[model samples]
Structures are given as C-alpha cells and as structure tokens.
Target: MATSVDKMSTDTQAESIYFLNAGAAQAEQDRLNRQHRLFDDMMQNDLLPPHVASALSALKTPPKILEVATGTAVWLTEVAKTLPLDAEFVGLDYDTTKFPSSLPPNITLRQADMFKPFSGDLLGKFDVVNVRLIIFALKEGQGTDLLLTSVEPPSQAWFRFQDINWRFAKKVGRDMNLPLSMVAYIKEAGCVDCDDKAYPGNSQLYTRGREDWISRTNVHVKALAEQSLRGITSLGGVEGMTTQKEVDELLACFDKEFEDRIVHYLFVRAWGRKPEAD
Candidate 1:
C-alpha cells in the first residue's frame, strides 16, 4: 500500500520549461511502469531476493525506503505490498503530475530534484534507496555521483544497469555518451558488498504471449528512440553530426533489426550497502 504526501499540484510551467516535452512525460511514465511490471513478472514477482526482503523485515523498527527519480512510483508501491505494514516508502520525483491520486498509507510521494543535494534531515534516513531508468535524463556519472554523496549510513542503494556503450551507440547513429558502469560508481561511493547481475532476454522469456509482448516492447522502444533522436540535436548540441533525415533512416533500421530479432537488450541491477560509523 502507498500514501500520498501533502504537496502542491505539479508546476506545469516548470515541467514544460525543464523537460524535453511535457506531453511525452506521461507516455514515458506509462512505458516505464509497463517495463517494471515486465521485469517483476520475469523475476517470478519478487522485486528483490528472499534474503534481501528478510533482512529488511528483520529490522527492529519499520524500514524507511526512498526511491530517487521514482517515475510513477510503480516500483515502490509494488514492493511495499511485501513489506511490513508499518514500513514507510517515499517516491521522489521532480515532476508530480504522474504520481497516483491515491496511495497506501505507508507510501508517500515527494517532489524533489535528484540532482540536488539532499537536505540534512533526509541524509541517511532510509534503509534502502532505489533508482532505475534515469539514464536518459542524466549525463555520464551525474546520477551515481549524486547518490554517492547523498545517502546516509546503514542505507543501501540500488541502481539498475544501463548500457552506456558509446561505440555501439555511434554505430547506430545515436550519441548518448553514457558512463561505463554504474556499479563501479557505487563502489567508489564507499558502499560495501556492492554487486550486480545481468539478465539477458530472449524469445523464450515471453512464453504465453511472446509476440504480443514483443509488439508492445517494440512500440515503446520506437517511441524512446524518437525522443532520443530529437534530443540528439537539441540536448547534445552536436551540430550537423547527423541530419533529421539520417535519424529517420536510422530509426527505420532499428525497427527492422528489432523485428528480425537481431537486436538484444540486457537488464542489470546493482546494489551496495553503506557501512555503519567507525
């Protein structure tokens, strides 16, 4: 269950000024929610391992969880169902428009920028801080750097692996310039027991409705690619590296590659725990 925090309505002007497209925000949120659902289903409906949940459940007091850049707060709400009744969950996002109208009493939504430093009260308050799929919004190393300095002791941080292969991106005609490894950043942040695991997807994972899932995923990917293309010229400020016509051609190529099952995507999750004071 989740609870809504008392906060002002989303600032439409700020959102429009800050985001690439305000309208696309909702679409992206829907796509991300679907992706989270797919991951959970693929992992047998367990968001984390039995041991992780057990460790959190054993805390003397209710665990306080924070999710940075929590688009739609889908992950927090889903995981909250498995935790103790008193466990508190907070989903922080810069934009509040996508937050649900109602939430479980234990869950709260906060509108905050993840790029900025956390307030003193927020430092080290959470048992777990979760982040996922904000790579497109972040520059290389920016997200990981913020997490490293912001979280407090006894807190665990988790980040989903994003493929930042600039070479492969250049071949596809999209220049994202992402970092080499987010997991490495976590280790640099002084978190103990940092670990990551990758999950490769194939045709068999879809099982009952493989074609349908693929069709939907393809649509989502196409939309994301389109958005990324638009940002290429705008956000990257790379003048004349590729024309709009070239981007269209590349997108077409991507669609065909995906349909032909020649393109594969990998999903990875990394986690680390902060050591208690000396």
Candidate 2:
C-alpha cells in the first residue's frame, strides 16, 4: 500500500547530467518507444525474468515496480498489462519532457536524478527495480567506452562507423561499455543470484530462424544512428562530422552496410535479487 515515489520532486533536472543522445523531440521519443519494443521482442516478450515474474505474481499485496530512466514508459506500461490491475509502476528520470501525459492508473512518473539518493520512503520499497540502456547518463570514471563487437565479419564501412561512434562518444564523455560490467556491479552491490544474458543484433542474413531479430536490429540501429547524429550536430558537432551533409553521407554508408549484412552488436541484460530482511 506504500506509494512508489511519494516525496520525490517532479522538477526537470536536465542540465545536471551529460547525455550524448539526449532529446525530447517527438521523433526521438518515437525512436525510443520503437527501441523498447525491439528489446522486449529480443527478450522473448517477457518484461522481467521468469523467476522475477513468478515472484511478483505470488506477492500477497500489490507489487511495486520501478523503472529508472524510463523514457515514454513503454516497457513499464506493457509490463503493467500482464500484472494485477492494482500493481504499482513507478518511472523516474531527470527529464520529464519525454514522460507521457497519460499513463496507466496504477503508474506514476517522477523526476529524479539517479546519481542522488531517493527519498527515505522509497528505500527498501520496490519489489523490482529495472534499469536499461543507461550508458549515456553515466559520467567519466563511472564507466568505460569500448568499440562495438560482433561475431560476424565487419565491413569496412561498419568499421568506419565504429571509429566514428567511438570518437563521438569520447568527445561527449558517454560510456558505451557499461553493459559489459553490469553483472559485476550487481554482485558488488551484494545482490544474490546475479546473472546476465546476451542478445546479438544478428544483422547477418545467413542467420536462419532469426529473421525477425535481424529486421528489428537493423531498424533499431538505423534509428539510433540518426538520433546520435542529431544529438552530436546539436552539440556543435564532433570532429569529422560537424555538418548535416557529413551526417547524411555517413548514414548512407551505414545503410549499405546493414543491407549487405555486415554489422552486429551484443545487447546484455543483467539482473540480481536484493537480500531480504531477516
């Protein structure tokens, strides 16, 4: 019966963080919602892990779920559909502009910075806390940025994009490799049964039985590339990519690489359970 984020303020704190792909444009929000669906499909349409889902269902009271950096609340809203009607869903983010005006009756959206502690009432309250694709929000030394890796052979154009993305991330101080370290961070936080699963982008045409994943990956990559370029150019641009013409030319090359089946990246999901009170 406790509220999700009772005392947390609802003011935007956009300037407090450095996010390379940050945007509140409708196009950006649409891209994020599309990416959310792609990720849900990649995980086989399950919002939470099997065990977690089972635990939440078995709870006697209405379960509390919190999603950090929840853009558009697409994932949370979808998860809400599968749970009890009274189950509570809370979404926290620094920017409220992207938050949807209409959410499920059981859901609440709040403005909060992840770097800061939540109000005392929120501590030890959530039945599940979900954070995804938060690499852009981290600061230097908080995480590392590494080049993309794939099982398939990369094309020259793919490599070029990798180099560009690396340089752009460096210039903007965004961490791209934090996903690789999430399980370690979870274990360090004293969470039990920590584990992670990796989903490959699988843009390879020869990968049978994954046609859907291939299509989704390609679409997600293209949209993300465009969004990143928009963000970069808005920042007065990164080296070798300071103009709209340059961004377009690079995107064309990236499209060719995707069409030729020459690009892929691993997406990892890590989770752990907090120790219960004795």
Candidate topping lDDT: 2
| Alpha-carbon RMSD of each model | 9.9, 4.7
Indicate the residue-level lDDT of 89 in model 2: 90
Q: What tens-digit string does per-residue lDDT give for candidate 2 at 1-278?
A: 12334223223233433433445557778888888876665566778888899999999999999998887888899999999998999998766667887987899987778878886867888999998877766755565322655524466655666676677667767656588888888898889999998776543344464666566666766777777776667666667878889889988976776652434566788999888888
Once model 2 is optimally superposed onto the true structure by TM-score, how far is the C-alpha of residue 273 displaced, in angstroms? 1.8
TM-score of each: 0.70, 0.82
Question: Number of the top candidate by TM-score?
Answer: 2
Cα lDDT tens digits, model 1, 1-278, are 12332232243223221223334566767766777866665556668655667789888999999999787899999998888888999898877767888899999987777766776777879988889766545543353211222111121111110121232233334314322376777888999888876554343335886766566655655565555555453433233324678556656755554442312455567788899978
Score residue 124 of candidate 1 by CA lDDT: 78
Q: lDDT for model 2, on a 0 to 1 scale?
A: 0.72
How many residue pairs in model 1 have overlapping backbones?
A: 6
